[model samples]
Target: MTNSSAKTRAPLSRPIIAGVVTALVGFTSSFAVVLTGLAAVGATPGQAASGLLALSLTMGIACIVLATRYRMPITVAWSTPGAALLAATGLVEGGWPAAVGAFLVVAALILLTALVPQIGALIASIPASIAQAMLAGVLLPLCLAPVTGLALNPWGVAPVAITWLIFARLAPRWAVPFAFVAATVVVIIGVVTSGKTVDPALLIPQLEWTAPTFTLGAVIGIALPLFVVTMASQNVPGIAIMRSYGYEVPWRPAMLVTGLGTAAGAAAGGHAINLAAISAALAAAPEADPDPRRRWVAGLSTGISYVLLGGCAAASAALVLLAPPAVIPAVAGIALFAAFGSSVQQAIDDPGERIPAVVTLLVAASGVAVLGISAAFWAIVAGLLVRGVLHLGRR
Candidate 1:
C-alpha cells in the first residue's frame, strides 16, 4: 500500500473522532423520547433505565462485531422512531409486560426476515420516495421541538440554538455536538444558580426486569407496527446510507445479530435495536475518511462510545429527568435537523410520487393515533393507497 493509504489506515484518526461524536449524538438526540415512550407504556423509572442500558450495550457490541467481521462501517442503534410509536400508542392492556412481549415479537419478525431472503428483498423493494415521505412525517414533529422550546424557555434554548447555527456555518460536522455541549452548560449553570441540591446517589441506575406477557392486541397493534417502522424507516435507510458511501456489507447477518440484540434488550425494557439511520452517514461519509476502506475504524469508535454511554445510562437518565422537558427535545431537534431536511427533500423530489408522499408526510406529522397505532404506520398505508389510485388512473 502507498504511504497515503498507510496514513489513511492509521487508527484513532479524525474519522474515529467523528464516529465517537456521532454515537453521542445518537444517544442524546432521542434518549428522552425513548424514556417517554417506555413510561407511557408503563415502565417504571428503573425499568426504563435498564432498557436504555440494555439497548446501548447490545447495540454497541453489534456495531463492533459487524464492523470488524465485515470490514465495513456498520453502526447499530435503538429504534428512535419505534420508541416514539410506542409513546403515541399510549397505555396498552397488559402495560409494560405487554410492551416487552411486543418487543420480542418484533425481534422475532426481524430474525425471520434475516433467515428468509425474500423478506429482506421485500423491504428493500419499498419505494424510496414513500419511505422517505413516511420518515419525514415521523420526524417533523420532533424537529419542531426547537421552535417550541424556544417559545417555552428562550433563556435556556437560545444559547444552544445560536451555538448550533454558528458551528454549522464555521464547522458543519460539529454543529449538533456543540449545541448539546452548550445546552449541557446552560443546564449546569441553571442548576448551580437555582441552588437545587441533587444527591449523587440518584445516579445509580436500578436495573429492573419485567417478565414478558403476550397479548393479541399488543402483537398486532404494537409488534407489527414496530417491526414495519424499524425496518422501513431505520434499517432500509441505513443500508441506503452505506450504499451511498460505497460500502457493501451482507444484510442478513447484520439483521440476525441486531435482531438477537434487540430481543435481549426487550426483557430489560428497550423497544427495538436496529441499524443506525441518521448517524450512519457520519461514520460512512467521505468526511469520515478520504479512503473508504479504512472507515470501519469509525464504526469501532462508535461502538466503544456506545458502551461507555450504556455504562452511564442511569446517570444520563437522571440528568435528562432533571432538565427542563423542552430542553431535551430541543437538543434532539438540533441533532436531527439535517436528517429531516434530507428526508423532506427526497420525499418531494419525484413529481410522480409527490401527492402520495405529501399524504404520508401530513398524516405522520399530524400525530394521529387510532386503535393504539401511531400515525407513522397509517401514513405509509395512506401514501401507498394514493399511489395505487394514481397509477390506475394513469393507465
Candidate 2:
C-alpha cells in the first residue's frame, strides 16, 4: 500500500510540471500574434489587452472544465491561425466594433456547428487543398515581416531573427519563445537608450468592452474566414491529435464549451478559442505521464496556469505597444514559419490542385479588398471557381 501510494504521487508531479510548461510555451510563443491581430483590426491598446485577458481566462476555464468532466487531456487554446487571418484581413467596415461583431458571429457559427451537424458537414465539404491554399495566401504577407523588418530596423530585428534561427536548429520547440524574449530585450534597451519610461499603471489588466455592430462586409470578410480557419486548422486537427494519442475527445461538448467561451469573450475583444492542435501533445503525450489516465491532470494544471497568466495580459500588451515598430511583427512572423511551411505544403500537394492553389495564393497575397470584402474570402471563392472550371465534366 505504501509503495502504490508513493508511485501514484510521484507521477502527479510530472503532469503538473508538463502542464505549467505547456501554458508558458503556448502563451509566450503566440501572444504577440494575438496582439498584432487585434491591433490590425483597429483595436486600441486597452481593448487589445482586454482581448488577450478574455481569451486567456475563457480558454483556461474551458480546459479545466473539459479535462475534469471528461477525464481526458483535452486542452484548449486561442485560434492562432484565425488570429493570423485577422492580421491579414486588417480593418474591416465599421472598424473595431464591427470586428467585435464579427467575432460574435464566429462564436454563433461555432455554436451552430455543435447543435447542427449539417453546418459542420458543409465546412468539411470544402476541399482541403483550397482551404489550405487560402490559409497559405493569408500567411504569406505576414511571414514576410522578418525580412522586411531586417531591412528596416536591423538593430532591433537582427537579434530576434538570429535567436530564432539558432534555437530552431537546436531546440525547435522553444525557438519562438526565445525569439520573443530577445525581442523584449531589444525593446527594453531601446526604451532605456531613448530615456523613455513605461507607466506602471498601464501594466494593470483591465477589461474594455466594445458594443458590437454587425455589417455585411465584416461578416463575409472576417467572420466567415475566421470560423473556417478555426475549424479547419485548429479544432479539427486538435481532435485528430488527441485521437492519435488514443483519446477520444467528446466533440459536441468540446465545441459547445469553446463556442460559449468565445461568445463570453467577444464583447471584450477576444477573437476565438478552440481545441489545441500543436500544443495538445505537451499535455497528452506519454512524456506528460507514463499512465495515460493521469495525463488529464496536466490539462487541468494548464488551465490553472493560463488563468493566472491572464493577469499578465496587460503587461504583455504594453510590451508590444512599446516595441520598436518592426520588432514585434518580426517575432510574430518567425513564430509562424512552421505553420506557413505546413500550409504551403498541404496547399499544393495534389497535381491537379496546383493551379487553383496558386491562384488563391496570389489573390490572398495581393491584399485586395473588393466591395469591402477582404482578400481571404475572395481567395477561397477564386480557388473554388478555378477548381470547378478545370474539373468541369472530368468526373
Best by lDDT: 2
Q: Which stretches of candidate 2 lie over 4 Å from their true place?
A: 1-10
- lDDT string for model 1 (1-395, tens) is 78976774645577789779779878876677787678778887778888889888889999999998998888999998787677656677688899899999999989999999887777667677887787777677777889999999999889989999998999886777778778878878878888776677667765678899998768866787688779987888899888988987688998999999988888999789999988899899877877787789889999989988887778766666667658877887766677678878988999988999999889878877666665766787899899999989575
lDDT of 1 at 301: 90
Per-candidate TM-score against the hidden true structure: 0.87, 0.98
Error of 2 at 280 (Å): 0.5
C-alpha lDDT values of all predictions: 0.82, 0.94
Report the Cα lDDT for candidate 1.
0.82
- Write one digit per residue (lDDT tens) for candidate 2, span 350-384: 99999999999899888899999999999999999
| Best candidate according to TM-score | 2
